[model samples]
Every structure is written in C-alpha cells, then in structure tokens.
Target: MDIATIDRRRLIGWGALLPLAALAGCAAGPGGYSLDEGVRRLLTLSTQRAFGRLLQPGGFYEDQLARISPPDAIGAGGPGRLNAIFGAFLRSEAVRRRVSLALNDVAGRAAQRAAPYVLESIRGMFTADAVRTLRGGPQAATDLLHQRIGGHVVEVMVPELAGLLRSDLLSALSAAAAEQTGIDYLELGRTVAEQAADGIFRVIGREEAAIRADPAATRDPVLIALLRR
Candidate 1:
C-alpha cells in the first residue's frame, strides 16, 4: 500500500526478524571490510559464550540471546519457520538501562581489549550476508561471510551487534520484568522498543508475517505514526 503502512511494520520487523535473519545468513559474505583478526576473536568470543551456557542452567538469562536460546531461524532447526517479515520499533533506543550495563560483563570479566574490533569484523561479515540474502542483490547469497563483512561494515555490524550487545547486557530482562511488572502493554512496549523496538523483537517479527498474509488485517495505527516520523 502506502509508504507509511510499509514503515510501521518495518519498524517491528526491524526489531525482530532482522536480528535473527541477519544471524542466519550472517557468515555468508560477498563484500565489506576485512578484519581477519576480528573474525578470529569473535570465534573465540562465540565459543566462550557457548561454554558459559554449558556451565550455567539459566544460560545468561532469557532464551533469545543465550546459547540456549533457539538456533538462528535460518538453520535447519530454529524457533519458528521463516515466514512473512514484519517489524516494529518504538522511536526510542534507550528503553533498557540494565541490559546496557551487562554488555561489559558478557564474559564474566572486563571485555577484552581486542574484542570490540573482533566483534566489529564479525558484524561486517553478517551485514554483507544480510544484503545478499534479503536484498537479492548482485552479490549472490553464497559468498564468503568475511568478504561481505568487509563490504558492509557500518550498516550491518553497527546495528546488528547493538542488539546482540543489548541482549547480553539485559541478561535479566525477561526475569526482571516478570519479577517487577506483570507484563503490560506499557512494559512490553518498552521491552520491544528497547530490545529492537520490535517487542523484544519477537512480536514485531510475527506482525511482519501477518502483514504479508493480509495487509488490511495489519491494523495498528502505530504503524502509521511510525511512518510519518
């Protein structure tokens, strides 16, 4: 339909599916900067985080970002099947403070000095893959993730890891919310907006699929509001 209609849903889809979608096609890169060092470090970080999950029961809080969290939606086994895409994100990015604090503690110690660059490199890889997978561009979907990372550094890595880091920081997000508030629209709004403005990025994903099924059925006025801004 109109641009606004598309945007409202995109905001939510932006929140939810984008993160997981990015992850699924993440390593497949076709363009972007090169940080061989960063990729190596990320592999280390990823493995370390996976190890943490093995040692802990809760697995770093909620099941989304934790190692125990569901597999990337793209892989053979994941949360829900990849369906239609939708996204919702409140305008605010700073909805959660506690989660931000936890980023430093992701490894149970000071973040390694080399980790940021390493993570950045990994992010670049993911972004390139996203462009190929989602955009269906000249870059085929089956390229080196590193090449893509080198190609689309800022667009992919910045936003992608921002969410991942937020997830890491908010190790207690779901738990804390359940404990303090009884889960209301207001809280959930904050949760969704904060995480990705996508309702913890999950509902936004669901909405995207809905819109594709029946755009007329996508009846949230907020979508309109999101578009105008």
Candidate 2:
C-alpha cells in the first residue's frame, strides 16, 4: 500500500501524532517534475513538521515511527555504552526548538514539493517481511524516521537559519560524542539518516543503470517491440 494510503487520520488515533498539519501548496510542478530545489524545500518542511510532532503532547511518546521509550532488552547497565548513547541523544534542547518548527512546516506544506517521494519512502517501508535494516534498539525506529526525513530538511533549512544557530547545530552534532548525559538523539539520527540517504542514492543509481541498460526490462517490452516495428 502507498504511504499516502496509510490511514494518516488513523495516525491521530495512535495518539502519538498530535494535531499537526502539512505546509505548502501542490505536490509537484510542471510535468510532475520534482525539481531538486522543490524537493529540498519540501524536505525541509516535512522534516520540521515531523520534529514538531515529536514535541507535541505525547508526540514522540509512543508512536511506532518515532518512539524513544527504550526497550527491555536494554535494561539499565546491561547494554552499557549503547544504553547511554540513546539517553544522551534524547536530550536535545536545540532539536526541541528546531525540530518543532520543522514538523509544523511539514504538516502545513506537505504538498508544496514532492509528496510522492516521501510517500514512496513511507510506503515502500517493508511492504514485505524484510529483516530489520539496522538495530535501532530502543527508540531506534523513530530515529529511523528522522534519518529518512532529516537531511533534505537540513539542506533547505540550514540556509534559512542564522549562521550562528547553524553553527550551534553543527556544534551539537560534533559534541554529540562523550554524551555522558544521555543518548545523542541528534547524532544517532544523523547516522541513521546518512545510512538511509546512502541507500536511497544506491537505489536511484541502480534504477537509472537498469533503465539505461535495458529500457525494455524496465518498461513494457511488448509495447517497445511494437513501437520498434
């Protein structure tokens, strides 16, 4: 099923989404092209919106997509450093504000860019029984959410923010290590997002290569043969 087809309204019932609205206008542009610039804008908006949702009342409390409430397998010192990392990452004063703004932007301006691609990511989400791509551990799933949606957001939003604030975020990311306080949610997110982005590019490359190598394999071979005649 398509991500868009997933009961977005039902998400509200999950009681984890809060009352958020998407921003922007329209899903695509001329010839349905999702220009890089447009995609960047939408990515920014969508990520911010997701961030806001995490902050909303019970926002990141229980939603499967963004849950951070740790797992039993990670009880206390049993997991050692891994357990502490999630805690440090979770303490995000900077993320609290920026993420909140971004989430709202996404809710309001969902279509201003390319909904199909985002939706594609959500929909393609293991529409089959696949192995867990990575061990997110406790709240790793929500971390996945951030990764899937963060960078495009950074690409668009970092430019809009003051240089100082941008520096702070970069700083926060850098200082994520030695997170003696708790899990470095921001850093954790960066790692996940980076990995996801890599996968996305790989898929795109493979598809492009396949299409170039055998147009017929990627298209309706019967139709292509008839056209050749």
Candidate 3:
C-alpha cells in the first residue's frame, strides 16, 4: 500500500503508544510525543507526499514550478560568430520543449530511485534544535532538512539521471539537438538532477507550510500535539 494512503487513525494510535523511553535522547513535548519525534514525523510525511506526487506521470512535465527548462546558456551566446549561430538553433522553442520533456522524464525516474536515499537521510536527521525548528517559519523544518542532506540527495540522483539520459530512448531524442548544437548530455544530466532535487524539496516545503497553517486538517495527533506546544 502507498504510504500516503495509510490511515491517519492508525498513525495517531501508533504514535500515542510509543514509549517515552524509546525516545530517551529527545526532549518530550505535549502528550508524551517528543518535539524531535514530531518534527521527524512531519518531515517524513511531507517527503512521502512529495514523492507520491512526483512519481506520477507528468508530475514534473506538467508542473510549472517543477518543469525543467533548457539551460540559459543555450540562448545566451558568446562574442564569437560561430557561437551565435549555434545559440540561435538551440534557442528554438521546439528544441527547448523536446529537451525539457526528456529531462522531465529522466527526473521522474531518478526521483523514484533517489526516494530511498532521501528517506534514509530524513530518518538519520539530527533534531537537536527541534523546538526552534517547530517554532520557526512554515518551511523551517524543510530548510533544516535541505541544509543537512540536500547535496547528498542530489549526488545520489546524478548518476541515476545521467544513466537514464544516456539510455536508447533519450539518446534518440537527443540526437538532433546534439548534431545541431553539440549539447553536452552529461552536463545536462547533472543540471536536471539538481533541478529535480530542488523541485522535490520545494514540494516538501510547501507541504510543511500547509500542515503548519492547519495541523488539525491533517488529523494526525502527533502533528496536532506538536503544533499545540
């Protein structure tokens, strides 16, 4: 079953049942749930929800905020005449759309593979400042998560995205662009991977903000309890 589909009541009951001793190192907040655990749980839920949306077809392609565009350098040529000629071809809307679609496809798959790494990072996250994180802005937890592991997650995704970009399917799509502009597929892969990682965090941050604004709407007792404090 999808983690996003898990019943809220079950999660609430489970959280309520957790022994305080199990969370010994962390400081407890209201209703026996540690602020650290609360922050962790919130980040976990946000990450899961972000991945759930991103794993879908057209997740990146259709999302205006998440969609990958052709590199700006493609349209910005240097002083050389030869560079100007190549830049014009690379700037074509058709070329940009084709490149973006390929990048989005690769980003979706790379994200699928990177999900485990992201979750592992979240699980190992240090919540030494949980109270400050919880009390800060809506995206405070997400900002902290990114500061801690964003680069690592992007690194984990790079090779996977690069591999996909080199696959037969993408290679076929890239052939025309390559012949016309000598586009560097490897660098493109890295750019898309980084952008994809950013998009994932952006979605997670949005979820964090929404949840904070109305924790009761989530119906998760742990979140509600944490917010109350």
Q: Please give the lDDT score at residue 200 for candidate 3.
A: 85
Worst 10 contiguous positions by lDDT, candidate 2: 127-136
The TM-score of predicted model 1 comes to 0.18
Cα lDDT tens digits, model 2, 21-133, are: 22234332233422222233222233334433433444333334433322212212335664465344436766444433333323222222222334344432321111131
Candidate with top TM-score is 3
Residue-level lDDT of model 3, residues 1-229, one tens digit each, is: 6533343333344334433332676787777767877787788777776776777776888876577765655221243642554556557777657667777888887887677676667666668789999999989999999888888878888888767876632463455544555455566678888889888889889888888988998898878878763
List the global CA lDDT of all models: 0.29, 0.34, 0.71
TM-score of each: 0.18, 0.26, 0.81
Clashes of 3: 0
Q: Candidate 1: where are CA atoms >4 Å away? A: 1-34, 37-40, 43-56, 61-123, 126-186, 189-229
- Model 1, 1-229: lDDT tens digits are 7433443343333223212222342333223212232232223233233333322333233334421121112212222322211001111244333433343233212112122332344333433333223333221222233233333322323344434433553354454433232223232222322332111112222323333334334342322222121
Ranking the candidates on lDDT from highest down gives: 3, 2, 1
Note the residue pairs that clash in candidate 3: none
Please give the lDDT score at residue 204 for candidate 3.
87
lDDT for 45 in candidate 2 is: 30
